[model samples]
Target: MAPKPKKKSSKFSGGKGRLSRESKPVKWIESMAVDMIVTLKKISSEYYHELPNRPDAHEARLFYKNIPTRRNRYGDIPCLDKTRVALIDARDGNDYIHANWVTMPNARCRYIMTQAPLPETTADFWSMVWQENVSLIVCLTKIFEQGKMKTLEYWPTSCGKQFHQKHGHVHIRNVGVRNEPHFALTLLEAVNEKSMERRKIQHYLYLDWPDHRVPICTHNFLQVVRYVDEEIANYKGKEPMTIVVHCSAGVGRSGTLVALQSLVGSVNEGQVPQVCQVVSMVRKQRAMAVQGPEQYLFLYWALTVHITSCCQIPLEAKKDLLKRLVLMKNCSTKSACSLSPITTDQPDAATSSARQARNEDGGDRKRRPSNVKRKTPRGSVTVRKSKP
Candidate 1:
């Protein structure tokens, strides 16, 4: 006789027969999460050092070879010419910007993953937004990090600022700017100088994400994702609009956020999430998405947190599993580090407005919570402790 299958060591696994109604969904999700994390960790460990070498599609190689592509901020990372988005010359102009259109099959989600806009490329960036009829722009990196300029201030800070470009000219006005605990919302109005026509766009600048790193708590990030999806569902036009997302390189942080969003989307649809599959699909569309193992691991944590929050798992039970299933993984490495415990709270409007004003006046300094202080070096998992 064949040997009996080994008992699955999971929180939900208890000499399985039939599970209780409440326990069934939570147990299924928990088991699925464990398997997903193991697979991701294995994949990350094997490919942590470098991306797998794969030949580019023929047309993409042609663009890489023949087309005049702009030099990326980092010489090492280049946008594959084949997947790069080209300007609608007949409608916009001849200049092409470095942005790619990525769509996920299961999630039915689409994104324009582009690099942080250079000063010269800012106009082209706006041009692409206008031509593509993009309704949302998700900025994942800070404009400046450690006194180095990471991304340009592409949008008009104040209302009625005329932004001029070689191919097109438009007046960009900031209609409203509201800052929440984790992210900022800026409503923009763009007026075409030639036709005097106008359009509205929403910009979400997520502040919690550190440069070249992942957030300690995924709660706020999930809130932002939910907020964006809810807003996208309200689009009035017939053609679905694309959401533009970017970080400094458009691969690391940007990729992580997109991958997490895709996984969460699948889970919300009552399907088990496959983290590695989502990451691989995204990488195929862009390149080097979810850049490192730490980031890859982060997607799992964010998804787990989401499941617990949605499933109404008891705080003690959630905490126990978090300690056992999530924190058990060793995250410390040269490029990655461990984070402190997570805190989850509902978003407050008044607090958001106050934070916005403070941010406007003092910039990043005011954004740091006063009761907490960073206990780790840069590029590591920063731990924040409350003041005694």
Candidate 2:
């Protein structure tokens, strides 16, 4: 006689559960109705743009869980002062950071950008740039991000549980995308003891997601971009700074970020074809490691949404944008790096005015309650701390 099947785990199995023991793609709730608000910010010369109004997605988009926020205005410093690809490897209790910068040519010649290496000196590099100001920071490594490779060995078509045990996944979603008890953590307060002025406004992107627990995963990666744009509005001078994009390997996601940046430049610099062309060039330099046709299709959809989101071009103007998209091709990365620093081009009339206002309102520093932190529970569980 066949052995009896083991009893299935509870649906609330410590904040995680399979849709069914039978095995299938995890069920997803479409358009779950999250309240996402949009607001305008002056980038220069009264040139205003619309963006999300929160640090991470709509207040309701947290998958019914609270996202982990910082305490005492510390912890990874968010995007405000970081110059481009500022690395953040805060695992369990261990904290680490690294950043890589590169320049893809536009009208700005001799641009101060170069390719970034994997896992460099985070303490020294990010610290130096964080203390200063930069127009934008780019992550060069994200150009050709091939997702983490697995052996070509055939699988027995068993359960994910067994598959998971064979491979070690450091980032596990439990209390909040990731949670593992550790003995110690290096306090951010102690590291950068002497705090400097934070730029306040910044941007970021997440690439590949080999691990299942990443709060910002493949389908939801766009949320990171949404949140960065939201937090930027409150920044002093409202001047948006460096944007860092990464994936498991930092290639595909980074490429997407660069491509978007190039598209935004089309609107900001008022140079249409040039900006689009530049983005195409970057892609050629780094092959997109996005899996099969579905992911590629997602790219097309994402690019359209991203461009319209930044430019706010009316639906009427989308026809021309669509035409441009059709003509665009892969970005070239051969000589993509190895270029001199380009001169910092000034913003146009409208953008410059907005920058001035941000400067006038800049100096004041704001910090949230030192003890409070946005909690993101694993699976769908939200922890409610007792009110003080």
Candidate 3:
């Protein structure tokens, strides 16, 4: 039998031997977490190098047969059939698309990660959106990136314009469009003319991300995430909705966004978010959820920044806190003093206790005793309960 694994003493510190799934960031109250910024940085650096390589692409072999029809930017990476999205056909029945369902059971977030639709697959993409009842579409790539076609112009760019694909019998009409510095919003109505049913789909195109890397500035990126999250919550439905997210190849920037949303959503839900654990979970559902070490590191940096922002620590206080943290780290736990030796403006425990005692004695000298009755209103009674 395999020997039992050794347990880690600190979750923020990198672990020993093999990686553990349940390992996560330490849970601290909102106020206490500001002190953990140093620890967060340390763990992020360590964990960035510790992430496992992408598992062998066992599904790669299946892509060659569908190369003519599929539009994956990377030919070597194909969605696994087990998790790949399937479309029902009238005659052929159950065709596969280069999309996977990424579900985070704990945070209650689900996403369909797909490749940039080719001109041919654009119709099928809308068909999937219609069938799946997707509430939001998160497009991470532009129509052109690095002077190459990164993503097809799948949606109608102008309001009151209509696009139809005869092959998939999909009709998309743009009703409204809104553009912002961070993202563009398009209100779309998808019609399955065969059934004569219409569905409203919200298209969100994130403008700043690169083809294979994270955004240079995370602020706008996070704003895009918040927009998607708010739209998901605002959606009115009994069934949970799936947000369709795609980039060039569907694994690199796409995975990064999905993982970011998952971790950030988890943090918002009062959970200590674990980058590796969340990435691992996403990869289980969609292979290579976080494509490389850079993307992996970005996830940590983004989370750390997000958490620090939520703490609302002033710039000066942050520097002071960091200095104090350095002092706490430099001091020895086995020192003569039980508490930290770091000097601070706040009074020490002994000083605080003495001050409290003095205040109590002064109150005793000035106060009326409990035996002396206090006046009460005519119609109301007053009761003073003794302190427990």
Candidate 4:
């Protein structure tokens, strides 16, 4: 029979070998992960040939140095001399090239995503982390929570409360690996406190959507609707609310929201195509990755909520609208002509007569000539106009 494993103790610690360990946990994207184990193995063995001078170690550059796959080994990659930065090329080549070290500015977003539960914040949090200069923030989890003195006081704030009040309450959640600062664990153990640093209210309950209620005002149209009835009394701005959305990738959630916004814009303006075109323009700017196929189909339905509005393209009500438009256009054109002083002393009668003469000449020029054959260099005969 196989011998049972001995466990760790004061005298002898058997490490992982002693423990009856199981297989490794599945990773989200194993092919692209720059795991701690691999990163360690790499740094320990590689040569850090000194490059006299190079901020050259920025995230985009360093990312390519340590290749993960044996089949796709990379050499001739410029050596990284700088600290706190590595280059990570996103366009082509190995994906995990810049896994570990990276430029401080570029690393901030990427590093944050690597650690445990995604970081969440209130308005105070958003202000600090927002990088207007580089719009594409490396994907990272952002939490929004209200109330404080909770266990996860480790929960950092990026934006301040002022920015959040107008939008809605702040909340957070983790899909898996309930880390030490677990939501449920924090709620039960921590005391809600109000001190020199933290805010007053008890933390709002963590929201788990789909498992919970699908949010009613998840999209901007819903927000506008809420505003129309004075639901969002303090809401400012007639312009569309800027919404940030991501579901692993910004495509799905963002596309859905943009689609709904298009729907709302159309309904509000009573012009459906106008909104459809608007959504199309946005998708062009940022990929409809938000729409991928599934969400795209749904977005089609969502935006078409009031399709009848766009169906006929509003045929000028009683045709009187067209007439009025034509009359207005004619008047506007005449007014423009009238505004310009006559450059030459052409009498009105002369002008009318000149126009008549031009018209007569035009009619003569437009007359059909008799069909005739003409000799050509090639001795070819074909239909031809008689010599004028």
Candidate No. with top lDDT: 1
Order by lDDT, highest first: 1, 3, 2, 4
Tens-digit lDDT track of model 2 for 59-145: 223212211421111121122112233224333432323223434442121111222322332332334334333322322222233
lDDT of 4 by residue, 253-309 (tens): 433444444344333333223323444444433333233333333333222222211
Q: In model 2, where is the ten-residue run with the lowest total lDDT?
A: 182-191
TM-score of 4: 0.27
Off by over 4 Å in 2: 1-120, 128-219, 237-240, 264-276, 280-298, 306-364, 367-388
Show where candidate 4 strays beyond 4 Å: 1-234, 237-242, 274-276, 304-388
Winner on TM-score between 2 and 3 is 3
- Per-residue C-alpha lDDT of model 1 across residues 1-388, encoded as one tens digit per residue: 1112222112211111222326444565466446655755565664554444343556255335434445355555556665677766323334455667777764333578988887656767877887777777889877877898889888754332343223246567665555556666665667777778777677778877777678744656766666555444434455554789998889888888788777766655545677777887777777777776777777766766666655554567766665565442345122232233333344333234334433553632122222222234652222222223
Residue 248 lDDT (model 2): 36
TM-score to native of every candidate shown: 0.72, 0.33, 0.68, 0.27
**Tens-digit lDDT string for candidate 3 (1-388):** 1112222122211111121222232223233246556754555554465554455556544455567754555776667656777776422443667888877654344688998888767767877887777767889888887899988888875654334323376677654455545456655667777898877666777777765566756555656655555444434455566789998888888888888877776665446777677777777767777676567766755554454434434555544543444332222111122211122223322223223422543531122222112334663223332234
Name the candidate, 1 or 2, with the larger lDDT value. Answer: 1
Q: State the TM-score for model 1.
A: 0.72
